[model samples]
Target: MEDAKLTPRKLATRIGVAPKTVERWLADAELLPHARNRVDACRALKVDEDMIWPKAVQERVKTGHDRELAHAYPYRSACPSTVWGELIAGASTDIFFAGYTNYFVWLEQAAFIETLRRKIVSGCRVRFLLGDPDGEVTRQREAIEDVALSVGTRIRISLEHLGRLGPLDGLETRFSSPEDAVNHVSLSVFRFDHDALVTPHLARLVGHDSPLLHLRRQGDSGMFDRFAEHAEELWDRGVPQTP
Candidate 1:
């Protein structure tokens, strides 16, 4: 549109639509193209419909070489069970995390511990950076999320569940100290080898309500590298879980 030097009104005129319709399309990312509107817009812009719409690309992803390369979950509630299960189950090298409380959900699955144990035996290093249960940060988060269960209590629950692993050889858990720059964990990450599952925080919503971005480390510098770097920095300043 910029190359064509067409204003929104001009573009709408060329596409035979109202100028306001173009504004709405630009504002709402979730909006999909209509049957005739897509064709008209593409014809006017002199670009393929797929260039302006993601659904076109998404439909072909299953047949592509890198099927699980990248994904976007609109909301945490919309994520499928297979997404997390496969990401964790397929990790061959290492697993890293930066989360508030990591136990409530995972421990519910009977195979969660068994899976980690098997991964440890296979030489996958497991590292976790959790928020300090007693910190003011946790208190603030609990109040903000308005959950009946507090963040501090959740962390305590996580420790109890993790303790059941019984002196794992290649597992380490750390708590983020106030001094740590990444102590304010607005985003939670779970990186397994070349893939990372990231959930960034949204205002007035609990962690679980945020969307998840599934990133793969393929190119020289991508989302995976960026998130991995952030996780590593947090890990470096994290305090030992027991300490």
Candidate 2:
């Protein structure tokens, strides 16, 4: 508020709260406004809600599971592309993408192939776990979605992009095994080192429409590790992508 040059009255007016309410919030450090008011105030102040009320944010984390969750998006597309770009740019050891098609990143992320090349050159292990385009699961998903650009086409498109990279050392691709194809197609997990973006597909809904969870690894037995282990198990059982 000070940096934004907003007075209590102005802030309250902007957030649709009483001026006295704003004054009380200012006077009492422990006082937390309603969630909606906090969001509105953050937007009006051009800052993050946590920046203004770290205590409130901390108090909301009731369990170890809650600690692992960094954020939640109503839809995968609701997450900012910059979040993906930053995670990809920042990871040094591991960059694992375990999405069925793994197609949207090619569209949403800028210069992804070059980014992969750089990551591999830096000794990062970059892996893609995709569903086989010709597999029965892909055919079933295509029929279920009934979209113009089918799931198999999307998987093939991702394969084509990966092929263009021409097999960089430290880069790998695999198709999930037949038995695990259903499980693989239902959940998408993309990991960058200790952080991950996960989406569980709803029946009849496309990947973009699925709810997303942004998780940071907090401990060995947290939600992050659970999802990471799931993807790793599928990868272990997967067949290497054939050129």
Top candidate (TM-score):
2
Q: For candidate 2, list the clashing residue pairs, or say none.
A: none
Clashing pairs in 1: none
**Cα lDDT computed for each candidate against the true fold:** 0.77, 0.93
Model 2 residue 66 CA deviation (Å) reads 1.6
Task: Show where candidate 1 strays beyond 4 Å.
Answer: 1-69, 181-183
**Candidate 2's residue-wise lDDT over 1-243, tens digit each?**
889999999999999989999999889988888989999999999998788899878887767568889899999999999999999999999999999999999999888999899899989999999998899999999999999999999999999999987587898999999999999999999999999999999999999999999999988888999999999999999999753
lDDT of 1 at 163: 82
> What is the Cα-based lDDT of residue 92 in candidate 2?
99
**In model 1, how large is the Cα lDDT of residue 113?**
74
- lDDT, candidate 1, residue 205? 76
lDDT of 1 at 55: 88
The TM-score of candidate 1 is 0.70
Clashes of 2: 0
Q: How far is each candidate from the true structure, as Cα RMSD in Å?
A: 10.4, 4.5
Per-residue error for 224 in candidate 1, Å, reads 0.6
